[model samples]
Target: MTSSPEPTYTWGTTSEINSFIRHLNKSHRILALCGAGLSAPSGIPTFKGSGSYWKNHKAAALSHPETFEANPGLVWSYFAERRRLALCAEPNKAPRALAQVARKRKGFVCLTQNVDGLSQRAGHPKERLFELHGSLMDIKCSNKECDYIDKENFAEPICPALAGDPEQPSSFSFSAKRTFTTQRRDATLSTKPSRTNAHEEYKYKREPNPLEALLESLSPTITPEMRQVVIPESELPHCPKCDSLLRPGVVWFGEALSKPMFDEINAWIEKEKKLDLMLVIGTMAEVYPAARFVHLAKEKGARVAIINLDAEHTGGIGLGKNDWMFGGDVEEVLEVLFEGVLLNG
Candidate 1:
């Protein structure tokens, strides 16, 4: 397909962007593919790059199946912290503007790799979005037989061992300091918190002074039960029928992308035939499947615009002369773009 003539705009000036907005408004269908960078202005952390917080840990630790299998309690704690962070963050102007645009237009779809759920909070229609990474607010049992899932506040007492133990209560003491190390149970299968380190390991031993103070600070009000304790995976909730521990339902590294989600996104792209424009904001565009969406849109002859603090040497394959590549802080650039062009147009 032939590319459309590049529209002229004074990038930093409102008039330039208003021209683009006029073009956008004329299109019948538009789709947005967002990444972690889109949420960074709202204070969510990016997964990879120089300033990322996950530098010490592998990406899989937060979303990998093996990590969950080895220590469901530890995994849940990680997500609980993320949930807390996300809840405190407010969606910035970009998502809000996109939502406004989406509401006014027909056939708009947003596919986001972020689990923060900010898009929904920003008033984007639920049916128009596909949260490909899964949501941090969702919890489910690891036991396949149980099929138990619930929408509980992540800040609530979350421990695998405490699942069925009414006598056992939830506490936040372990949420930040909790750590898990792998130990082989046997040749075939392994259990987390293996007998080797199950509460008796030298490292697991609480220091006499600080540990006591920590325990004291954990007021019983933090949990429903009066007792303040951190349950190891050994004490996590077990499947009532099969006696298996429950775990959070996050998509981790090395795991296949959720089949149902992939299918849904693919179906949307197929039905659209061609996207009018693609706004790639604040992402490095390195990851698979999610990054592949940009290629698909370009293949179908969509105009692509990239906005990021970092630069891509290739300018993304298939981006034409008409497409714009604006490099710098996304929020600042977007403020300029929207105020200059979109809002006025």
Candidate 2:
């Protein structure tokens, strides 16, 4: 792949993009590989990125099977917060557009790495969608014998221990060069230094990474004392039949996707002699198996297009001169990309 776009052309959005859109409209079989970026517009924090510091612990730390085994309470709490936010989020335009198109299109499949279920909320057909990472809304038993599973269990908090837990802090990190004071922000003396007079303005320079930002974002909702909360064994959610511990259904760090999903994908590939179009939407096709689909599609005479935020995104892996890269907010890109195809008339 060419490393960089020419200086004369900013992100390589030439008239050729129109030709690509025209081709997409005519295509019969299409595949969209989606990721966390698809749901970011709905005020949800991505689990894989730097912004995923849940209560001062790295997302990678809390999402691992090892962490869940040691402290189920703490792990459950992290998911509870994520679930709360996910339920509150409305499906954005990108999902709605995809759903509308999938309704009319016969050979479209969406394989998503997101667990938020936003696409389902947008009325995407169940048979056409595959969730690569298991949903947060599911709960399952740890014991393989029991194999107890509850799907779409939207019950708040999942258990009593997680009930009434404080909300997640701000999802962003800001940089401040110098201290600033505002009389209007915090009326109470809680945030203000005790040494400063109430009537006077107080300026404190806070360099927030993970730990430092914890106070400002959590305080008033989640107190500093609650940072290292660990639920008792009895309080953590357990299975009803086998009496084993219950766990979130998401794919952890050292887990493989279920075999049935692979079978479904295999059938899809075998059914088509040639895939007409492949859209890598909101995902860096860097991850395995899923990423390989992009290469396979291109190999089978499919026109590849990437819809993401970065123009020079080589991470999509299989992109080349013949492929198209529409760089922008995914919602905006999808809205334009599917304009003619989404029309019911």
Candidate 3:
């Protein structure tokens, strides 16, 4: 016969809360993996949900290497707005909330997937923090020969050309406009169905080619109102060393993470030798590499603690009896975890 399910402690229930408090106080090594959900209360949109569009382009589409190579101005426009939004968003109260615990627990490490720089603003110790995804605030040269890179730059409008409201009337070359309009008129939208365009639907089915991307963007499936920026390539941010095009420092799809940074993180893990706790916050570490890290920590004896907004979805992920799941707002969960629980490590 099955024995019983492991106890899942939510924000409520005094007994469970106290037990977690004891766990936090006794743990020697703790790691927290943060995600986009952590910044939700801070007014930063995840941009992963349906209908997240900018000038008829999805956030992911504009962030790709192919898109940037084809239309640097358009890609820059999207990222510029995102950077502005990130800067404008204040670190959530829960943000500083984690900072307090990290400060108290010397062995505690925070591994955040967000590139918004909120963790830094919240005052988490740099040595103890691991940014799996780099920050949007940083800048780097796109030219292969150029070695230009800048970190933690909060300056607005990064460049003069991307300045002004991003929602203003956009400009596209006559040829591009003509191609887009001609495609729209030629295709029959009513005949096709799906949130994605025909090209997107069959991307994996077809062989890879640069010509396909160009044709897809000009496809009728693109939002009828999609607009492209007019800023010439010459005016975009350029590398001081080679005057080459500049790109966001954040990692894009199909890009490898910084090896040096990973080395530092690996060193930290090896030095610690074992983990007592791993706070899974905001994000579900389901993807590989990131998931691999969490798996390693668990193998090293870390108990998983998930703190997220979705209670129903998180309830039954087959957590071991030793693990804890805190289902509720991040701020509330953090309050329960730190405040009134334990002040010092």
Pairs of residues clashing in candidate 2: none
**What total of clashing residue pairs does each candidate reach?**
12, 0, 0
| Residue range 186-269, candidate 2, lDDT tens digits | 222344332223223222222122233323323223333334557787888889998999998888765778789978886896
lDDT scores in order = 0.57, 0.70, 0.68
- Residue by residue across 1-345, what tens digits does model 3's lDDT show? 999853333333555566777888888888788876688677565544332456556655666676777778877887887787688878986778888777877888888888989999999998888788788989999986787899899999788887866576433223322332232233323344332333232211111222233243342242323335457888999888888899998877656777888888777777766888878887666654666667778878888888765433442234788777665567767876787534544
In angstroms, the error of model 1 at 42 is: 1.7
Please provide the root mean square deviation of candidate 1 (C-alpha atoms, Å): 17.1
Query: Order of all candidates by lDDT, from best down to worst?
Result: 2, 3, 1
Angstrom error of the Cα, residue 80, model 1: value is 1.4
Quote each prediction's TM-score: 0.67, 0.78, 0.77
* 42-153: candidate 1 lDDT, tens digit per residue: 7665534222223133333335565565555555555665666677789988777767666766577888878888888888888887777777766666765687766534
Estimate the TM-score for candidate 2. 0.78
- TM-score for candidate 3, please give it: 0.77
CA RMSD for every model? 17.1, 12.7, 12.4
The most accurate candidate by lDDT is: 2
